[model samples]
Target chain A: MSPEATAPPLDESWVPIRVHGDAGGLEVDWCHLGPERFTAPFFDQTVEDRLRHPFALLFQHRTSIDALVERQRIRPGLPVRGLVFHMSRCGSTLLAQLLAALPRHVVLSEAGPVDTVLRAHRELPGLTDAQRITWLQAVVAALGQRRHPDEEAVFLKLDAWHALELPLFQRAFPGVPWVFLYREPLEVMASHARHRGAHMLPGALGLAPREAAGMPTTSLDEYGARMLARICEAGLRAFQHRRDAPARLVDFTQLHASAADLLPELFDLKLTADERQHLREVAGRDAKNPVLPFEENRDEKARGLTPEARAQTERHLRSAYERLEAERQGR
Target chain B: MSREAFERFRARVLEDPTLQSALQATPDLATFLVLAQRLSAEQGCALTESDLRDALDAARRTWRERWI
Candidate 1:
């Protein structure tokens, strides 16, 4: 773990997907993502497409994670320009889509391998915070390798529960302007009631006792609302901890004058007039499925909330919602 | 594929974008595997269908389930 050592270059197309114990030793498993553009809604979707072929599978590579660390030492990848964290079922995908509309940007939407690295500490016992930070940097460098010569910015849109690990990400990439995007709790809750993400399950994450205690022993919909409340609060608390942060607290609703104001200032991004128009087109499509047009009925998505889900959201998440709504006027 | 042949074939494929694209363009696994084995044999890294199946099964992800 010295500062001066370096390793030979590894191909950027074969990105690492898993970091785990391999026959009692730690290793990284990589899949070849080829040269295709990341136009998919999620990073995993892109990898899954590759997996549907023999080319990406038969040639998978396995090696010590240190190999990537050393490879990164030889060639440090793009520095992360911005981070996007969101409560699930929120508009984070739309924001990520907008950013990825141009070829100059590399946007990783809820990349699973990055999530595995972020949570590696839970499984790899006796791992120190320093090691974790170094590993995080290495992993990010591996993910951010320049696929296109014109690539300028690398943005990572993290999963909802990742907000709970804000301290870790902030520690890994300090001074990187980030935004915590969220929606009305009932809307988020309603969306989850229809199709629940793994994090919404009663005990899927084996979350902290405090989070577990907060969840009711009722329906999964109520649990999803409470879980969203916890995630939203975590992001707000992390941002509030450092008011000087180059960050924004964006609500789902456009009530905030600064909502979706975007990162020309914060992320140090520049867009031409044509690029801006292209992003407007990107935002008009569905975040999860870009082939489909954006559903105009924003309220319709939340209209299916069950009575119990609505009650739980109001009971548990109303305060957090109000406090965040106040951010609009303050902005 | 034997370990040496598999490794050699992979090395060759990694350096050949044309082959990569051809294999990627296959409509299904059967066609892809046939093209892959034929390509390997052309390069002196010949492998049987069982070897390809074994390699797919040995992958960490559920390649069999994926195909199924």
Candidate 2:
């Protein structure tokens, strides 16, 4: 064979490339590559080249997560100042979008990559403490890319499932502040059922069709009660674990009434006069709909819980809410 | 979905400098579906038909921009 032919496809000229993985999977793009075939070395070089560069890695392995955490811990660049936690559909989107519109802050809204990373390591039996730390580290690294040092902060609106993983985040970026948002339990249940679809399993409000089909169907009341219980439990757990952390609990009702006053106070963010005005405009628009339109169907819909189920959900939520409030007040 | 099919589809789209430029400019739903349709046809796959249809529906619902 001719030497030219044998020498491997002359490492296709360095060109920017975007590699898309499967749906709901990681997507990465790079500016350029040197003359090297797609090999291990090429991947290593790509990683190095993209250092301090942001790339979304969906379903990142625990090992990868560990490397990212270590990098941030040892050589921390900018602290991830903003993190938002919530039960799904609790006005998180509005808050995140508002924050995103502000200058000097990069907001990753419902980032698919975050979900992928959590799902990747969640199934494993028992990752060591160090391994678990790394998983969170990778997430921070992926979410923490800043083009300029002056870019005030990086904000991440975490996946609902990540409520269970708050401790990991706290351990990774201890300096970062977090906020948790909640709505009335009945309203939350109704909105979740209407928008996300119902599920039979515990804590499974937004199960996809495939996921729902995999589990045995239960009574709508039972499903609603279970979902509410799980959400309350998750919230309480997150609250208890991060008692000392800078956190705020914004009731959905209060947020709807006056987000302008609540949001700036919660985050301690200093907005310019124009920024504050812009925030008021956005908040006013969002606050107009205090009750989610779908709440009316809670009684008539298939996912509507029976009176007994409703009572159970309310009972659990009341206990959880009291505990959360007490913890917040340092009781 | 196969490697060969993916490579072929990529090549076909990249071959057209205009489409490639459009794709580079905006990787939004419209461009993605157009690229997917072209690739699916080149791959001799039936899956592309549904993909294109869904993409059209999504674009109409979200962006309200018709492709054809």
Candidate 3:
């Protein structure tokens, strides 16, 4: 037998959910996500919801990266409408949720398969950049497959950590409009302090080249601040690199006030009256958990923030934050 | 529950989009299993509900244990 196994050619009924193993040993886990739109807050939530389906459970398929790539050759998926990069806790979730509310849009919020392919370089030594951009493109294209006749556009809200891999993502989908959404440094830090993301930990994601320089990040607060700084700097660097790149900076400070108009204008999306009504309803609920009502907690977070953490955030993120603000305003 | 019988039925399903579409277009599992078993027997490969249940249960187990 060959070193790898080939899976069945993807039909419209089956979609890949995860990419397992490394370059030498690779496998793709698939489930029937067809006939079901991803309206949940996150990709996993959508997958979890489908767990109760007989089709999803009974007809699981496993394949190699080759099959994913092959499917792309046979049939391409919808062209991307936008790519969203965020500094976590920003209005990124809100943006994704709003997009999902529209019956004509397919929103993939922080999908795992995309992250795995983007980080393929980390699994193999001596590789400076992504080892499998082809797989990345294929997986994304596969997910963007139109399951509903009304599906008109696809939007991907990448993870906060993906800000570091901006160039790599840009390379995969050139000419696609992208946005970098951020909030006040202090507010974002406080939110993470309460319920931290794994990216906030030192070397949790196998230290990027920047953190590997021996910065000696000791505490969770410092680590989180430094990581935030890296994301800010990376976003700024990408913006300055390509002045003509279709990139926008979304502060999301007054997200509720500005998003209704800002989003469609920035992405050049035309919304119908029904879609507008749907957006209003979606915006009324928690973007991350639709079960709860939406509430703005910036004031609460500021009040709860420790003086020490605020100082640490300033020490690390002050310059980057100011530069980002300047760029957002200047543009 | 012969493996050969199920394999034959699966092969025909893969080759026939119309059959696959009919199966996918079924409204519910009870209806789907009835259609699937009937089609399996029509293709000169009879597969009982027990056979499909065992196969799908095994597939579900493998999928649940898949690495995310």
Candidate 4:
């Protein structure tokens, strides 16, 4: 048989490289990954690593995506295996990295292009819910292109802030399973106190009129506490309103255990004993700092919170934290 | 503009708080290009809106080429 006989047919539409700009206007940075690029063991690489492949030919121009559907003949993405939403500093990345280690899975851990459109939903106030949903579907379709024929599922670990936009995403892909990962509030805050993510910093997300109206103070710790609580609240609301979609709340404590047991069932993934072992090994390292060995530091993390930050967490985050814990315990 | 000219202009903008604010406050590409043109000129780098667009394109290419 000719090699062409077995090769997957190429769809000529460009893979969107990233989204740029705000609500008043939006632009998609598009690229075409040349034939043979996806045929390699590209699934093993990180999203950024795959994106950086030299075989990609990027368009110099940006498009408004007004003609996105007409211009791109996108293959419907592999049945989305699961979506991972989180409170920042949780073990969500570890979960994604473990899933990515599975031979048949394509995991995009916080891919920048995906985050771009989600953030644009807020930055561009003119974008209606319907439009954002359409744009999100297109973005996922572009990102979830099966790089290798063996790939069976694609998982997305969204930026933490995505919890706030849960309803919109649910509207976009209602059939996909979703999970929310969270750790206790003080531990999460303490981790941030050591080194803050851009989202946790004040003014990163320009406040909405509703949020701006209710804020009691704009101090760093207060802002962090309020933002973290809102993220937790959003997760709780989504899980409560899951309706028919498969959704679960995963505590940081349950993560390692779930790697072997619950996660596969949740995502409809089938893992061999060997594959499960490989996943267990991956979980033993720092998911973000994969070069280093993993260490258990929960006690250390709890101790790191100062009295002021601890008091702030207790004041602003206690109810949300208790609520998440209750749901995780199946209460 | 050459890559060097764009780099110089970008550096000057970063160093000046007012220019940074102007860039941050820019609502869209049209405004950004106008600001870039003015800043480039103040730094003696001959720049036009077209040149600024080319510079952005060049930067993207440079980022991709680094992977190659």
Candidate 5:
């Protein structure tokens, strides 16, 4: 075989599937998939759109960050426009999907690879703070490759726990606009009580052993409420501390009424009238289950909260929630 | 990694209550491997470290190849 034929493909189309550290150092798993695979939803592997794009295991091996950096130096990616940090189930997926509906926008909604890198920082072998932040930048750059000429912006909807890691992200993407999407404590608690998110479960978000020690495991409802409060507290504390960063506190209530106009202005998204119209249509559908029509879930969640549970949430999380709400209202 | 090896590991984790509790209590890769190794010993499955690593890599590859 010719030397060229035996060589691995080094193209911008390939993106990092996962980033982790081994005994040697940092390594990234890369897989090549066409841009269309990204443009469509991959939440459901059974979906026709997703099934059509069967990504081959390119080169049958992983690549190092040095190789990715060399590849990126040849073909740089689009700069990130904004970052979305949410308290989970607070219309974050909706906002991300809305932006994704627009053809010119690249919105990464709670991308697992990014979340894994962020969560497994200290756990990964030989990962120092400096190297971790550098790796984060490289991962985002690889994911932000502008496959289409019209692609103008790349936005990240970080995993909710990432709200706690705001400082790290700020250092990675300096001057990028960000927002913390939050809802009332009771509302968030009720939603979790109905169906617990992975983060709401004990130790799911990589909580320090000391932090998890305080949680009351006997009552799953109380445990969930306490865990959620910690997440909200972390977000509120970060938002308050990073006052100089281009940050905003967006209430869930405001999103339904004005995200179409507000997000563009806040995030500097220059959407055309047609794009706005399309976004509105996308917004009308359930973000998680797109086939279902969007229904008002707040009222249902409020009704679901038991009086005792509501009191428990109020006792544990209300103060932090109130503080966040005050920030959202510009108090 | 063979599909059956992956499926067996998943099934054992799900069926063993003690393993599930240990997993939830300490949700890290190190702890997970330790639990899987114990289970593999009892089940007589040749679940080597390489097998687990290959399983993780294969799972990641499948997720990227398919998921959005």
Candidate 6:
């Protein structure tokens, strides 16, 4: 493909990269590659491009943490100590907003480059471990550039799919502390049904063919379980395989109930009286935002999993939650 | 660290006071060095290895006492 043809249309911010894989299946447009090339193995003109043409708008927004890190304007010598991983539609957004309200942290929400990297990895078969490491390095570099030299800590909230890339992130930022947020599976499914429609539900979660059509299917409940399992698994496995290296689990319910009381202790930061007060007020006001409203339409809820089929989902989640508690207690 | 490097680091760190306090209280050279090296690498820029190494040493000592 010629540079122009391979290149996304000038106005387009994301160009689809075809992915061939076994578990996720071979597919076109599985992931996106940015126009800007930072490293050799990850992005190149022959396969990709460097800044020869004016930067084609590759993403709608500059939320790519990697791109921000490349800007090199971020202050140095700050203590960025937190990463938040979550299951979709849990209260993660609210938690992130609460954390961002703190005076001492900069929270980057659901940045795109990480997702792009994961998609590329999954789709493009035969990527060597070294190549994978280099891609991850590129992502870390992107995040580093986005740090403001003046900010002491940077907190990143990633999409749930990022859970699959936890091992890579653990290697990239070895010692950084992290927390995973999860809600009850039924609630998560209900919220996802309400917001993402049929698009986000994974197929193996017992989705019907019509419901699964045109949707990205992964083992949602199974993957969610594995993500929790990785976090709770003891020692270096938790550190090496879990995305939130030095990980902790925060129940969505608990976070909603006691965020103000818990955050300072967990993050090792002292919030000023005013900051604490502000956080409480924000939490209280947002509590009514309806985290997982029940869907009155049975058809909507039934799209992915039949009532009978969903029993397995419940069993999986319960097992995962139990394992997480066990891991958290150092069992 | 050079004045320029320090300033860049300072600006990002100071964006949040809690981080500022943590850095000020700790002032570990190793942590700063690691961060600086990582930042430079990410930006596709280069820094003198000696400078990064010095900062890393300082940060490690400080973090051991404070965080670890």
RMSD per prediction, one decimal?
4.6, 11.3, 4.0, 11.9, 12.0, 17.7
Off by over 4 Å in 2: A1-78, A147-151, A197-220, A241-244, A287-309, A326-331, B1-68
Q: Tell me model 2's lDDT, rounded to 2 decimals.
A: 0.50
Which digits, one per residue and each the tens of the lDDT, describe model 5 over residues A180-251? 888877788888878888777666666653475264455666776666677777778777887556788888
On residues A113-166, what C-alpha lDDT tens digit does candidate 4 reach at each position? 677667665577666788777777777776676666677777888888888889
User: What interface RMSD does every candidate have?
Assistant: 5.8, 13.6, 4.0, 13.9, 13.0, 18.6
| Top-TM-score structure, candidate number | 1
- The native-contact fraction of candidate 2 is 0.00
lDDT of 6 by residue, A134-196 (tens): 554544343433223344566667666565456666665677887777655556665553454
Model 1 docking category: acceptable
Candidate that beats the other on lDDT, 4 or 6, i.e. the better one: 4
What lDDT does model 3 reach?
A: 0.78
Which scores greater on lDDT, model 3 or model 4? 3
lDDT by residue (tens digit), candidate 2, A106-130: 5655554455445443334454555
Q: In every candidate, what fraction of the native interface contacts is reproduced?
A: 0.56, 0.00, 0.24, 0.00, 0.00, 0.00
Segments of candidate 6 deviating more than 4 angstroms? A1-79, A143-150, A197-245, A287-306, A329-331, B1-68
Model 2 chain A TM-score equals: 0.64
What local lDDT score does residue A146 receive in model 5, on the 0 to 100 scale? 82
What are the chain B TM-scores of all models?
A: 0.79, 0.37, 0.85, 0.72, 0.65, 0.36
Q: How many pairs in model 6 have backbone atoms within 3 A of each other, for residues 3 or more apart or on separate chains, i.e. clashes?
A: 44
TM-score of chain A of each: 0.89, 0.64, 0.93, 0.85, 0.86, 0.59
Q: Write the per-residue lDDT of candidate 3 for residues A253-301, one digit (tens) a residue.
A: 7566756656776678898777776677778788888899988888897
Error of 6 at A194 (Å): 2.2
Q: Candidate 4: TM-score?
A: 0.74
Ranking by DockQ: 1, 3, 2, 4, 5, 6
